[model samples]
Target: MSTEKKTKINGINFRTDIVCYNKIGKPILLIECKSQNIKINIKTFDQLINYQSSLNANYMVITNGNKTICFNIKNNKINLIKKIPLYREV
Candidate 1:
């Protein structure tokens, strides 16, 4: 896992909070962290979506320390998931 990983996409640089890679060094998951007071909503999803456009991660996660939401990205679509996958499962 790498925190605050920087990547350039479409001539813009993005700093992602948490990035996990596969054995081949391909990004598998991207996570964004927020304070527990903040609620997870569309704006949070939108932010992750924008980051995904740059990172091309297979999964996206948004959490406010209390609540977490995960999404699976496939074929340019985002689907909500129940929980984050275990490391071994990933």
Candidate 2:
């Protein structure tokens, strides 16, 4: 697991707030954190979706410290989940 992980997509560099990898060293999750004052919204989801292509993540999360939103990505589709899953579930 790492925070502020740097990644590159299409020649552009991005810093994701948190990234967790699997035993083989492939990123399995990507999380973006925001201050409590900021609410998670469509734009926030879009940003994570954009990052997903390069990260090849199975899940994406956006949080504002108070609230959290998790998404499962499959076939390039995003589906919202009620909560973040336990590490064992991932």
Candidate 3:
């Protein structure tokens, strides 16, 4: 797991909170964390969404300490995932 995952969008870079890699070193999971004061809303998902498309990660997660949402990225779409997969499972 790497805490500083960098991805670029329109020439600007964004840093993710956590990123997990697959056996081949390709990104598999991307997680964005926010302080309790930050609300988990559409805006909170922006970074995760950008990383998923750029890194082509299989999963994306966004949390604001109080609430968390998991997503499975498939065919360029984000779908809700019921649970977070273990490292070995990914």
Off by over 4 Å in 1: none
Give all candidates' CA lDDT scores: 0.86, 0.86, 0.82
User: By descending lDDT, how would the candidates be arranged?
Assistant: 1, 2, 3
- Write one digit per residue (lDDT tens) for candidate 3, span 1-90: 799757687798888789889878999998888999998877778767777778788988888878888888777778998877788876
What lDDT does candidate 2 reach at residue 15?
A: 88
TM-score of each: 0.86, 0.89, 0.88
Where is the poorest 10-residue window by lDDT in model 2? 81-90
What tens digits encode model 1's per-residue C-alpha lDDT throughout 1-90?
899878786788878889999998888999999888888988987778888887788888999989888988878888889999876667
Query: Clashes in model 2: which pairs?
Result: none
Q: Write the per-residue lDDT of candidate 2 for residues 41-67, one digit (tens) a residue.
A: 889877887888888889888999898
Query: Which of the two, 2 or 3, has more lDDT?
Result: 2
